[model samples]
Target: MRVTELSFEGFRNLHPGRWNPDGGVNILYGDNAQGKTNLLEACWLFTGGRSFRGAKDSELVQFGADYAKLGMTFEAGGREQEATITIRQRRSVTLNGVSLPSSAKLAGTFCGVVFSPAHLSLIKDGPEGRRRFIDSAYCQLKPAYVGALTDYQKALTQRNAFLKQSKELGRCDSELLDLWDHTLAASAARLTAARQRYIHRLQPIAAEIYNGLSSGREDFAIGWDSPIAEAILPEMAAQWLDALRQARRADLAVGFSTAGPHREDLTVTIQGQAAKAYGSQGQQRSAVLALKLAEATLLQEVTGEKPVAFLDDVMSELDTSRQDYILNHIEGWQVFITCCEPSTALKNTAAKVFSVKQGVINE
Candidate 1:
């Protein structure tokens, strides 16, 4: 898929900006914080209806403004499509003038994969960040996985509230808690299975990329760490429900449910060592890049369309070999890459270049 044209109104520092991008590499060069990332974020919002920088809908609006809007025209499978997003206190998003019932429904239709400086923390941060990384990848390839995760999170919230109330009452609402557990476990099991399947598909691709980047010096592995493993969906649901019951007293004392997919993690290793703890800074960056490229390939396999890539000043972090790998490997893909200066490396690669200065993009 390729974004042909993008327009922004009252979005961040960009004011009524519009551009038609080339299918190949598109470079946006500027000093720090000069609306370069803003343009990419606008594209991302059009695709997925959320701020990649972790901003809420209200925060996407320009200062002193109440709303923000992003519109994009793109091509997928030789057909043109239009997507638009409007941000106020709540975000309203649509595709081809048709309203989607929820963000989960909107996720994979015109999806894009992004790699930014902040993603370096994926390997070292808490489990929540890693979980989000997996969820984002899954959402881009499997819309049903996104819906399952939404239902799982909702069930978790309801279950937690019931557990808190039961603990406060000093008597067990065992029946209600059981009901919540059943629902939570059912949803959680499906989510866990989806996550595990994604990781399984990603493993070989990531390993190959990591090996190439590391010059065969390191071997990489990715694993899913969920409790309900090697079981059918119904059986896994029953197993988790029983586990919750077994942990009831401990959960009550802690005032939370502690034995579900929420406690799971994704572990990455290099040469039999934990990537987060033992790998060097360079190694961590390479692993993150490999993980992202693997995600893009998996999305392509699942959707039969090459997803757009947003690279936020990530080229400077890699050495010559890794940089060349990225620029050369992603041949038939749409890339929006931010740089401080237009490098000779990009001059030969970029299909379009836009100069960004003080919130303005000059085409």
Candidate 2:
């Protein structure tokens, strides 16, 4: 997919204007806090994903502005389509002039992958980061996964509230707890199956990319950590319900439901050791890079259209060899790169360069 036109108004520090980017590499260069990342954030929002930077909708509006509006025209699946997002007291999304009931409907319409400074946490931070990485990618490829995730989260929340209330009252209602347990088990089983399948598909691709990036010196593995080990969905649901019953006493003591997909994690290992605790800075970055590249490839293979790539000043964080490898690798996909200085390698390529100062963008 390629974004042919993008327009923004009252969005962060970006000037109210439209951008027609090159279908190949388009580099946006500017100093820190000059709205370089804001431009990319707009593009990411068009893809139905939450802010890669984790900014709230209220925080995305410009200073003194009450709302933000973004419009995008892109080509995907051999056709041209338009998407519009308006953020005020709430968010409203429209595709092809028809209003959408929920933004989740926008997934797969214009798929893309993002690489920002925050992504480094996927390797160095806790398991929540890795879980989010996998879920985000999987949701785009399979929109039904979003419903399963939402259902599971809702059931988990209700179950926890019941646990807390039971602990406070010193008595628990077995029938009420059974209701929540059944609901949680059903949703959890679906979510666990989806997550396990996603990790299974991602492992080989990520391993190959890591091996190439590391010159076959490092071995990479990805695994899903879950309490339900049954391969069949019905059996998994039964096992989850049994596990929840067994953990009720401990969960009540703690005032929370502690056994479900919400507590699960994704394990990344290098040379048979956990990467999060043992990998060096360089190794961690390499692993993250491989994972991202693999994500882009998987999206294309599943959708039959290459997802747009947003590189938010990540090139500056890599060495010359790694940078060269990335630039050489992303050939067919439309890439929007933000950096302080346009690298010499990019200057020699067919890249469209833009300079940003304050809120203005000039090509």
Candidate 3:
């Protein structure tokens, strides 16, 4: 997919103007806090996800403005489409002139993948971050997976709330707990199986890219580590039910889930050592880039349309060769990358460079 036109009003610090980015690479460069990242964030909002920077809806509007308005025109699936978002207390969305109940409804309709500085936490942080990384990408590829994930999360929430209350009561309701456990396990099976398959597809592609990024000096691998093994995917519900029963005591002791999808993690390794534990700063950054690029590749393979890439402040702290590799690896994909200083040498003649300063953009 490629974005042809993007306009924003009262969005963060950006001025009310439209930017027509090149289909290849569009670099938004300026000093820190000059709205470069904000420009990317505005484009990323079309992905139907919340702020990648973790900002709230109210925070997206300028200080004197009561709301934010964002609009974009893009081509995908052999056709051109237009989308607009009006942000107040919540995001109101319109796609192809049809209104959507919520911005979340725009997930599969208009898709994009984002890799921000915070995404480095996918490797440095705990398991939750890795799980989120996989699930978020997977959700775009398969819409049904969204229902499975929602069901699992809802059931997990109820189960945890019961666990907390049971702990307070000093005694559990066995019958009620049994029903809840079965419900939770069923949803967990569906969600976990989907996660496993995603990781299986993601691993090889990511490893290959990491090899290219490292010049074959390092070996990168990804694995889905679950409480139940992969050999019995069809019987996962029953197996998960048993596992939940077995872990009930420990779970109640902790007043939350002790095992299952929520507790599971994606194990990332480089040369047989956990990247989080053994990789250097540059190695970790390259690993993240490989994973994100692999995510974009997977999206294209499954959906037949390459999702736009938003790399916010991703060029910082990388070597010259690696910085160029990020562009080389995604030659055909539409990219919006942010950096403080984007010298003309960073991109070829075909690529577009936009100067951003004090919320203004000039190409």
Task: Give the lDDT ranking, best first.
Answer: 2, 3, 1
lDDT tens readout by residue for model 3, 1-363: 899999999999989989899999888888888998888889888888899999999999999999999999999778999999999887889999999999888777677888888988999999988998899888877877888988998999999999999999999998999999989989999888899999989999999999888877889999998878775655899889999999999989999988888888999999999999999988998999999899989888888888898988777777776776777888888988888887444765357888999999998
Ranking by TM-score: 3, 2, 1
Lowest-scoring 10 consecutive residues by lDDT in candidate 1?
100-109
Candidate 1 TM-score over all chains jointly: 0.90
Alpha-carbon deviation at 298 in model 1, angstroms? 0.6
| Candidate of highest TM-score | 3
TM-scores for every candidate against the unseen true structure: 0.90, 0.92, 0.94
Steric collisions counted per model: 0, 0, 0
Query: After TM-score superposition, what is the CA distance of residue 324 in candidate 3 from its true location, in Å?
Result: 2.8
Q: Give the Cα RMSD of candidate 3.
A: 1.8
- What are the runs in model 1 whose C-alpha is more than 4 Å off? 98-105, 173-180
> TM-score for model 3?
0.94
Off by over 4 Å in 3: 343-345
Better-scoring candidate (TM-score), 2 or 3: 3
Report the C-alpha lDDT of model 1 over 1-363, residue by residue, as the tens digit: 899999888898996878888888999999998988888888887666466787776777999987988888998767998878877777777888998765546566777878887888898788888888898788766656767988998998998888788789888777878888889889988988888888989999999988888777889999988777657889888878888889888988878888888889999999989998998988898889899999998878877889899998887767777776788768889999998986667777756998898888887
Each candidate: what lDDT?
A: 0.83, 0.89, 0.88
- Output the lDDT of residue 104, model 2: 64
